[model samples]
Target: MKYIALFRGINVGGNRKVDMKQLRTLFESLGFSQVSTYINSGNILFESELDTKSVLMKIQNCFHNTFDFEIPTIVKTENEMKKIAKSIPEEWQNDPTQRTDVAYLFPEADSKKIIEELPLKIEFLEIRYIKGAIFWNIKRENVNKSQLAKLISHKLYKSMTIRNVNTARFLAGEKE
Candidate 1:
């Protein structure tokens, strides 16, 4: 299946650096084909016959063996990703210019738990849980400033990755 693997803590601040070449090689070792990376921050798109969880574990193992590190990897199938895109809050959709982000959550999370505890200090930013991901309508000013970002990381227990709305759109196959 075609899937997007969102890797955490790679190529950040020059630490945990992973070259796109080696990244592609790791995935290829796992028997994934058509592998491609976007930007420098470990947004990988590839196809594999393994299940999502196994894919995650295999990548994690490969990372540890190759780089001596354990990086969190979240894998989502193309269909599930489509559901996530559809789950974005309507208000955010109407105003694309607003600074926004999408936090991809673990597939097994309890949605109700997240909704109840969402941070609300940032008025312009809101969160929606669709399928297994959190779609955030982050105000541009509040994008990097809001407590919601921290809340998401905390609430999700660092099992998620926050990518800018534009990047998310591109990964989701939306036109610029």
Candidate 2:
């Protein structure tokens, strides 16, 4: 299976630094082939015979052993990533007018009917939930006024690994 491992909170603010070359080596050491990293935010794409759960467990175990920190990871199949990217409207690009993001939720996180659960009462905030992630778009000018702006402080934020729409497109093989 081809898997994309979205690791959370790594290589941020010069902390939890993980070199792309070393990260590739780490994945390769676990018998995964075609391992490659994108943009150094711990997005690893690779092939393995094991299922998604098995791959996640192996990576987490070896990752902590090698790096000495537990990485909160969400593993998605290539098709799933593509679906996530496809679900977003074409107009929801991050630009001067609006910002779009995909919050890839952890497996243990309760994502079902998340749109109704999330605090999206603001008029400028647009939110949608599929199986594995939440797609949100907010007007840039109104972001500060919207409850979505405080997602970082929200409880659901703890269970998510967010990426911009462009990153989501790239991960889905829909872009450069």
Candidate 3:
């Protein structure tokens, strides 16, 4: 199976620095094939026969052992990513006036419960959920008014790893 592992909070603000080269090496060392990293934010694309659950377990253990730190990792199969990318409207993007984000939720928390918890301000938000993730958008100017913008302080935030639409598209193989 092919999987994309999105590591949260790494290489941010000079904290938890992860070198992509070493990351690739680490994934490769796990016996995964075609291990490759996307950007410096810790998105890794790799293939393995192991199931997604098994893959996540192996990567989490290996990552902590190799990097000496623990960070939440969200894994999605290539098919799942493709569906997510396809679900996104063509117009939503991370640009001058609009911002789109897909929050890949951890297994324990990927549910309608979190979606229900969102106090969405329709004027500033557009949100939807399908299985493992939630897609949301907010006008850049009204970002502060969007519940998603303040999600960082919400307890449910810890259960998700967010990516901008651009990153999501690239990972889903929608961008070259």
Candidate 4:
């Protein structure tokens, strides 16, 4: 099956540096096929007969053993990723004025609980839960003032990985 693996907290702020080339080599060595990485932010596409959970665990363990850093990995089938990409609200698509992001929730995460924990409402922010992911939009103009910024320190933040709408779409093969 074709899948996309999203790695969290790598190659950011000069921390947890992981070479994409080496990552591809590792995946290849692990018996995956057609492995490819995008942009250096730990997005990998590959084909494997292994189940999603097994793939996720294998990558995470391999990465930690090789790099000495714990990298959380999320694996989703191509169809799942495509569904996620298409789930974005129509109004958020191609809108330059809005900063849209999709938060991939951990397998153990409770989407309903997370949503309930978030602020009751924020005028400049819109959030939706779909298929174990959180789709959110923040007006660019209000980014600095939006309470969504507080998410960084929120406990739930550690349980999910965020990707920009464009990156998410690209990984989903919605864009060439």
Candidate 5:
């Protein structure tokens, strides 16, 4: 099956410095086919017959062994990503004033509970859950003032990996 694996908090701001070339080599070494990485943000596309859980475990272990740090990985089949890319509201897709992002939830995350825990309402933020991910947008102008912006330091942030909507679409093969 074809899959896209999103690795969280790696190769970002000089922190968890994972070289894409070596990462791809590791995937190839694991017997995955057509392993390709996207834009240095740790998004990998590959084909493997193993189930999602197996793939996740293998990749996580490889990363830990190679980097000496635990990097959370989220795997999604091509079909799943396609559906998620299409789930964003059209208005948000075209709105230049908004910054749209999709957060791929960990298998153990309860989407309903997370949604319930969010503030009752935030004028500059809009959030929705589709499949196993959360699609949210923050008004560009109000991002600094938006409560949702505080999630970076929140405990909930640890359970998911996030990507800009455009990047998500690109990973889903819906965009160049």
Candidate 6:
């Protein structure tokens, strides 16, 4: 199955500097095929027979052993991506600018509970869950300043990558 591994805190603020080539090598060494790293932010797309949990554990362990540091990782398969893409709330789609942010949640995440705990003033926040993934659409200028994004890192306890609606669609290979 094709999977995307999103790593947190890599190549950010000059801290965890991992070259894409090394990242690809690490994934390939773990038996994944067609390993590709995107945007230098630790987004890796590859194919592996192992399930998501096992893949996560393997990748995390490899990263820890190779880099000597722990970085949260979130794994999602291609099917999961399709489900998340289809689940973008209709209401949010009506106002594109109001829904400029897209967050891809881990397959094991409990989105309902997380949604319920969001801070107020989120303004037009919408979440859809299907096929073991959660898709969040939020209208916000700075994702970091958004309450939903701020709380997600704590709630999921896994690495997360927030792309603008454009980047999310691009990663998902959805037509603009």
In order, the Cα lDDT scores of the candidates are 0.74, 0.87, 0.88, 0.85, 0.84, 0.67
Please give the lDDT score at residue 116 for candidate 4. Answer: 74
In model 6, the runs with Cα more than 4 Å from the true position are 89-96, 106-109, 127-160
Candidate 1 has a TM-score of 0.82
Measured on C-alpha atoms, candidate 6 has an lDDT of: 0.67
* lDDT, residue 137, model 1: 71
Give, for candidate 5, the lowest lDDT window spanning 10 residues: 115-124
If candidate 5 were superposed on the true structure by all CA atoms, what would the RMSD be?
1.8
lDDT of 5 by residue, 60-126 (tens): 7887788878888889999999999888875665367778888899877746678666543466678
Residue 86, model 5: lDDT of 86
Every model's TM-score? 0.82, 0.93, 0.93, 0.93, 0.91, 0.75
Per-residue lDDT tens digits for candidate 4, residues 32-143, read 9999999988899999999998988788778768987688888899999999889897567537687898899887774666777864356667888887688888878887
Show where candidate 2 strays beyond 4 Å: none
Q: Give the TM-score of candidate 5.
A: 0.91
**Tens-digit lDDT track of model 6 for 1-176:** 89988777788889978899988988899999988877887788899989988999998788778886777777888766656665665455426356544555555564555555555344545565454444566555534455654564475545245655555555566644
Q: Arrange candidates by lDDT, highest first: which order?
A: 3, 2, 4, 5, 1, 6
Better of 1 and 3 by TM-score: 3
Which pairs of residues collide in model 5? none
* Candidate 3 all-Cα RMSD: 1.4
Model 1 error, position 95 (Å): 8.4
Candidate ordering by TM-score (highest first): 3, 2, 4, 5, 1, 6
| Positional deviation of residue 97's Cα in model 2 after best superposition, in angstroms | 1.3
- Stretches > 4 Å off in candidate 1: 89-97, 107-110, 141-146, 152-157
Model 2: worst 10 consecutive residues (lDDT sum): 108-117
- Using lDDT as the measure, the top candidate is 3
Considering summed lDDT, which 10 consecutive residues are worst modelled in model 4? 115-124
**What is candidate 1's lDDT per residue for 81-163, written digit by digit as tens?**
76777666545642545756677776556365665566556465676667567766765666666665457445555656778
